[model samples]
Target: MADLKVGSGEDIIITSGLGSCVGVTLYNKSTKIGGMAHVMLPEFPANREQGNPAKYADTALDMLLDKLRKKRVNLNRLEAKMAGGAQMFNFSSSNDKMRIGARNIEAVERILQEKGIPILGAEVGENYGRTMELHNATGKVLIKTVKHDDIVL
Candidate 1:
């Protein structure tokens, strides 16, 4: 479920089957340049040195930013949108670590804040899975859920 992509005008980036995973998008309206990442974990494991950067919120964002920079995107003009991050299954213990969805959301928000990127919209922290679509041309995100109506963020 870990994946990331960057694109320009008219490019629609889509990720499906988001349960505890989160979908994050960064966009620059003026340039019509943006990126999306389907983040599977909150952070990278300290013991690991190498893996798919897209698998963690922290590394995925970093990779996305780097790609955007390579594309000459203005980081100062970036805005963010997010969806998914659902608490897919019920947990018996009240352990925060099991709350992967919430953790993923928090990690992304914190990183965006540290980078001074404002979040323009979000649809997170529910109990159902979601599918997200990023319309790079319009800088709009469409959130689709099986139990709810579609949301445009």
Candidate 2:
């Protein structure tokens, strides 16, 4: 599933159980408004499906950006960091959608570039899961994996 949260420096947004899902964060250093999205799917319908805005990469990014704008955060000052998007399940199928983890990473990166948000760091791709926390106060992303030491990006 996908979800989005936007908050100022006083807040810390967290997302967990990211197997083939990517946890992305966009942060504005000046305003200290951070936005995070737990993206499940790579894309959404062109017409915009009547579903959760945070349920897909396409819609989730848009919604998060809108929220950031509404909060008076300058887009030009924004940067992105991501974690998760692991290839959790192995499959013989070559279908792109089946490679959810990689697809999610690619889609998220593409969207962030389109929005002019530089990707400062990322912890993506592998055969594991991750939990991420975005600290709005310092623009730091804390990524925790079950079998590895904690990573800060």
Candidate 3:
């Protein structure tokens, strides 16, 4: 997770070449604090974070929120935006893991709802890759996809 804490000033964080990967940003407007994570899996083995929390959605979010809390950011004021959960490739494989992209998005959304953090915006789930940028100054997410026009959320 990448974080710009209180008094850190305006900073933009980005993750490029996302495929079957989700980039989630959490921000507190009042504190001007924000964090982003490049999530590869919806959940970890047994859903445990172990060492690298950023490797999974659930653990990554936990780590991010803890960081924000340490910076004195109000959890109640937190808003979330996400992007880049593309299918990435085509295969006839029936394995559920092959659908990791969609599952990653689902896990993220579920976690947000459970934490009472509203999803302000999202650009997810397609057959193409995406790159996402989080603007800490405005809490706006910029998404660029190969097959679709760029979008801001």
Each prediction's TM-score versus the true structure: 0.98, 0.95, 0.89
Q: Give residue 75's error in model 2 in angstroms.
A: 0.8
Clashes of 1: 0
What C-alpha RMSD separates each model from the true structure? 0.7, 1.3, 2.6
- Which regions of candidate 2 fall more than 4 Å away from where they truly are? 46-48
| Per-residue lDDT of model 3, residues 12-111, tens digit only | 8888877888888888887778888888888768745465667888878998888888888899999999887889788899898799899999999999
- Sort order, lDDT high to low: 1, 2, 3
Q: Over the stretch 1-153, how does candidate 2's per-residue lDDT look in tens digits? A: 578999886799999999999999999998889999999988886786587769789889999999999998888999999988899888998998788899999999999888889999999999999999999999999999889999999
Best by lDDT: 1
Per-residue lDDT value at 52 in model 2: 79
lDDT for position 83 in model 3: 85
